[model samples]
Target: MELLETMLRSISAFTLMMLIARILGKSTIAQMTYHDFVAVITLGAITANLAFNNTISIRILLTSLLTFTGIAYLLMFFSMKNRKLRSWFSGKPTVLIQEGKIMESNMRKLKITLDTLNQELRGKNIFNIQEVQYAVLELNGSISVLPKPESQPVTRKDLHLKNQSEPAFPIELIMDGDIIDANLQQNDITREWLHSQIKKKGLSIENVNYAVISSNGNLYFDEYKDQIEHPVDKE
Candidate 1:
């Protein structure tokens, strides 16, 4: 049947895509470089054709996909080994802000306007340009910011506090009322402990929208409903 054929094609295409992605490692779409961008777009078009185009046979589609994957892997390997090739493939990070002053030349070269720069800065919680000590425009179109020493958050080390341990990244234990068993196991937490925490809050696991184990080994949870009380401003 035509419906079955379509379903088979869709499944095959998706499986192939996933296999290719796994082989390529975990450089997400956001982290992709100029070379990767081109390859990904071309691969997507090929995938769509594989899924829908009757003219393109599965054998040809797979061949094309494998060819592109091989090329991508080759480029990735070379880029990692060669600095010049890496720079050419990924481009270089440009200095957008230095010592609280905007570099107009670099901005113009990158085609970034003052307003756009300000917006990106604001996204990093900087309202004013003067607060930034250094800001580099990464090749992947992200800004790496360094705030002035005074503007930066005061750390425990800065206060001469000792015996402070490095924090672990928070691990998601539950999402949309479903337990993330792998994450729980990786973090060395048991389901019994999670259920106990939920019961202590006078809530059920099903009522929880999301839950995470914080760096300090605390259970942070968000219920399906908003429960915070906000004071209204009279002014």
Candidate 2:
């Protein structure tokens, strides 16, 4: 009976956690703000105790979870409505670099070192800080960089070229031999058209391991039986 109770407790706690996480939306761990970080940690700690701590009552655990989630929801609601509250809770983005000049005062206030700044800059494919016109340290601890005019990627406008190309919103049509019906519907594509494309490749939908509609409306597919040599692991 004790073992059965333990199993039941684990399952219940797991289900409750999934439901609560869904309510919190899909912000990944790296994207979570300071408040979200604390909330996630607290939730995990609470859920862990609820699942494994035999002494804690299910009623108390459930109540605590619901209360915490409710409070979190309220905080989100108020923060959205009030700028001051939002600023206080979520904080604001800091200017780390502006016009090729490092904001030393802002960096010092943010407790960021020169090396750390350089490392982040390198991560953004920027080795030289002088190339950056603007660099914003986001609330989520990510650096958003705007390169200097001379360092920026050359575009069609720069070359005086016209009709370069339209934006290509590629859509995944099939994955693991399963058709993504929603994507097809979103892209206004029919299964008949897809089948016709597959025929051109001398294959069928079931033979496809993965498929995508490219920007040029071309159907690209990888057949399940296609043999391709993978690169050796470098890492």
Candidate 3:
């Protein structure tokens, strides 16, 4: 029947889309460059037509999808290998502000207005343009701001304090009462050690909703029930 055929086509298209997404990798989902945006729109169109346009043969729809995907893959690979191709595909970062001075010509070239620039600066917690040493317009439509040295926050070095080594990233050891065995093994931590730590806190693994080893090498556990007298953000 036509209804059964439609259902089958929809399911097939959905499956193919999932496979394609995995093949394209995370960068496509995270950062949308000009090429990535165009590819996504095109892919979406193809997917929708394949799912609902029963007038078109399934073979033709699939061929279009696969051929487009193959071409995109080739372009991405070459773009990585060549600087010119990469610049053409991703576009170059433009300097909007240099040495505490606004580059009006560059801003005009990008069609960015003064109001838009101020709004972007405000988003980065910069209320005054005088505080900015450099501001760059990235390919992804984000403005990267560098504060003037005098306006920047003071660091430990400024106080002539002893420098400390950077701490390791936090590692999750348990989630929803389940132990992450791989994380434990990778970190060279034994099950017995984790159980002992939990026992010391007068709690068990089941009592923990989430647990992680902090950057400072401290074990932190969050229980399912948080005994807060008054939740400020309670809706």
Models 1 onward score TM values of 0.66, 0.64, 0.64
Give a tens-digit lDDT track for model 3, residues 1-235: 8888889989998999889888887777776778878888888899999988988988999999998888777777777666568779988788899878899999999999999999999999999999987898988889988787567677866578455333344678886577879889998999999999899998878888888997546789998778898868732
Which segments of model 1 are wrong by more than 4 Å?
Answer: 28-30, 161-235
Question: Candidates 1 and 2: which is better by lDDT?
Answer: 1
Better of 1 and 3 by TM-score: 1
Clashing pairs in 1: none
Between candidates 1 and 3, the lDDT winner: 3
> Model 3 lDDT vs. the true structure?
0.83
Q: What is the C-alpha lDDT of each candidate?
A: 0.82, 0.81, 0.83
Across residues 1-235, which tens digit of lDDT does each residue of candidate 2 receive? 8888888888988999889877876663556777777788888888988888889887888898898888776777776666568669888888888767899999999999999999999999999988887888998999988777568788766699543343244578986677878879987989998889899888877889889976445668998776658846552
Clashes of 3: 0
Pairs of residues at least 3 apart in sequence or in different chains that clash in candidate 2: none
Worst 10 residues of 1 by lDDT: 161-170
Runs with alpha carbons beyond 4 Å of true place in candidate 3: 1-3, 161-235
